[model samples]
Target: MDFQLIFLSVPLIFIAYKLFNRLRFKLPPGPRPLPVFGNLYDIKPVLVRCFTEWSQQYGPIFSVYLGSHLNVVVNNAALAKEVLKDNDQQLANRNRTKTIEKFSKNGMDLIWSDYGPHYVKVRKLCTLELFSAKRLDALRPIREDEVTSMVESIFKDCSAPENKGKALMLREYLGMMAFLHITRLTFGKRFMNNEGIIDGQGQELKGILNDAIKLGTKKSLAEYLPWFRFLFKAENEALAEHDSRADHFTKKIMEEHTIARKKTGDTKNHFVDALLTLQKQYDLSQDTIIGLLWDMISAGMDTTTITVEWAMAELVRNPRVQKKIQEELDQVVGTERLMTESDISNLPYLQCVIKECFRMHPPTPLMLPHKANANVKIGGYDIPKGATVSVNVWALARDPAVWKDPLEFRPERFFEMDVDMKGTDYRLLPFGSGRRICPGAQLAINLVTSMVGHMLHNFTWTPPAGVRVEDIDMMEQPGTVTYMKTPLEAVPTPRLAAHLFRRVAVGNV
Candidate 1:
């Protein structure tokens, strides 16, 4: 009898141990995690939507397991502030996936660099040397020239006898234009702009860079279950291939710059020149500088194009909106010339249209992962040290509690209240908010808004042949920067006076 009683008590002891382990973490409420895989089975095609659904069921803050990693997703404004602002210092380090770290060159650049003295120093350098208002003003000529070149290129293509009134790939045109603008500004050199078209080796190099970035952004089950990495051998191979191509391309450019620097001692006023100037002061190497250059190109080029394309797609889908914006532009900007960057603020409706697009389609939907430095309480949940915290701004943008008709695309909504995008406004953060907000926010905004303003001022866009307005696919490819699955194709006919289209171009106005 005594032996039997001791055996019965053993089962109770085992139960108590399991309970203690669960209680120790004090993790926020979430769906029960399964053995081995955790919550991996629950993730959907679109991560933001999946998080949005989970937020509704588990409240604003909840814990999730991507394999063994604990991810705390914030889906509301107040909680976003608590994580992104109140505890920013504790959560300043980026939570890089293994693949991303390889692409970031082990945190050599701005976007993926860990929070530390070097990150701080480099950020200051970028702020002062690259993105300062004075620097931006000085680069106005470049922006104007590129914008005019893009407009001229489009007009030429559409006016051609073979392509007249046909569906021109607008998004493709804009993507190349964005690439040209960024590369030219970055190195003070131009490529892929022969006859105002992106072709030849310029296109090839851009493709290689894009392929590598896309590889880094691609989701990996191995990130969660490290031991299962062997299952993703194909992904690993693709990553290495693209990474090698990117490294080769960037190194070639670096060599060219070095040769130019030595021959004439003529430093072009560009990012590479600035970094080379302080190479000794910062103790930076060629590899480190190349990594940083990749960071800038990866972060800058595609996002501006994505934003402008989404904005244009929305406008074309809603003709009333397109008409309304054109009327506003005609009134304020006038058909006499293209809109200037300085005139951005003066056109409130255009701003509102941009705000609406950001609301629906943010460039970085997950706002880049931020890792906790130490254990902290966020929204009454135990966010363990080293845990990843991601603020789903897309979920917040569509929170009915935050906005009326959260999913609807309505620019007029902005007219009712004052909403800004300068990282201060959590409600509409296209460039994110708080300590880790995008360093290049000002430049990106100017690129997107100015492009849209000029496009609206100069042309009347309609849905391409055979495509109904309602048929536009707003579906996005899931990644760090969600690109439209179907490229935006449109028929752009110059609505402005012929002289304004021809004489003023983009920058002259």
Candidate 2:
């Protein structure tokens, strides 16, 4: 009986292997995938590097497998334009990962939800109610206030004798500035007062929010293999616990604001207040509100912050480009006051610099994964309805065919060029293209322009006394968004202070 069972199992195993091979679908030629796990092990840890490398070998478009999952990457401007834009509706849905599906409260957040009624409604709310141009203008003062706070903080640091002489980690400071500003915009209160930060606990809220952003985005084994998810179920429980704490904090702030609004009957519109109103109008669940706020926190804090850091790093690396930008800022925005949104419109050189930054360092590198709703053909290859489509914005921007001297940081490329970063020209979409583009596009751009302008106008930056310009650590680290592998630390020499002859002594704190 045992011999017969063993003999029977041999053929069964053979048949199973054959079946798995047969199930393999035709895809664009890529590195050969192994059995069961497919090409999962072959893909690089940094997705941008993998895509950039693969595009070289596979032409503009290629197909690869991720543990049996099919992902089609569009690496050129023409394909990205034709496929992601011209044929958008057919591929409008987000590629639902097991993890995104689970944590999104069963497909609730804007990023994970499919292209249907739910997505449409949420998009409309965000576009019309939350982030409209008029609404953004109304919120401008809040952003200005935040930038002012940041400049003040920098000034204080520069003034401190113990801290004055040392190079400051501008990336860390910029990230915290972005976070606190976003949080204040949402909560409509200075939760982290200036004194609080000075007292060693002011930035704690920003620190917690940053921690949550990192946690939520950290790639997990469960994301790739569903069967092994039970092994790290503790992560899910921990995330939920963190969510509860975040929710409590948000809800408490909302409650206080709501009570004050009711008492005074003042109907001043703020983001949190607007969301509560949305809750009533849409009959949104409590979890939905919390989840949506979490999305705002995560997206707002990380992407915008990383983008600004990249822009600054690029500026620091290319002094000629940086000088041109400062020249524009000086002409458009004089020394009497800080740069504002009104000045952003006339600063073409500055705008070009920002676009160049996007070209070099797109926040996502690969725009969020989009799923095909029905079978479609891109680049003569038939992609099934359920397959995942990734628009390699990073690769597309850097493709030598599309960009002249693609690797060099050149903002002057856009000096007279028609390609804007507004997603209209698919050749250079930083915020993404089609319906899935970032809703925070306008606000993000405005904030970046204002901040960058302010930085250039206020200070002249340099590498530390001994560090060579070429040796400034430009290495990149992998994350949901790329940051300098080593943080951007620079010695900020105040131009105005230097002119006055009061030497800002650099010291190690």
**Each candidate's TM vs. the true structure?**
0.89, 0.89
Clash number for each model? 0, 7
Against the unseen true structure, what C-alpha lDDT does each candidate score?
0.79, 0.74
Residue 437: error of model 2 in Å?
Answer: 1.2
User: Candidate 2 residues 1-509, lDDT tens each?
Assistant: 99688656654654565355336544566676554455678887778788879888977788786655678888888888767777799898877665565456666877778889888877888888878787787777777777766666676687679877678888767876776677766666555543634222334555556556666568776666554567787777866766566666767777887897789876445677778877778767766666666667767877777888888878777889888887888788776666677888999999888888888888888888889998787887767778788888888888777789999999889875778787888778888888888898888888988888777878877777787777876666776577777888777766544332221221111
Q: What is the lDDT of residue 196 in candidate 1?
A: 52
lDDT of 1 by residue, 1-509 (tens): 99688556654654554356468877778877665566889888778878888989998988887766678899888888888788888999887777877788888877888888878877877877778888787777777677766777777788788988887888777877788778877755677534455556577777887687666666677887675688898888887887778777777776787888899887766677767777788778666787778777888888988899999999889989989989988888777777788888888888898889888999888888899998888988888888899999888788888899987789999999788877887787778777678888888878888888878777889998888989999988767788888888999888766555442322211
Best by lDDT: 1
In model 1, what are the clashing residue pairs, if there are any? none
Q: Candidate 2: where is the Cα deviation over 4 Å?
A: 1-25, 198-211, 497-509
- For the record, the alpha-carbon RMSD of candidate 2 to the native fold, in angstroms, is 5.1
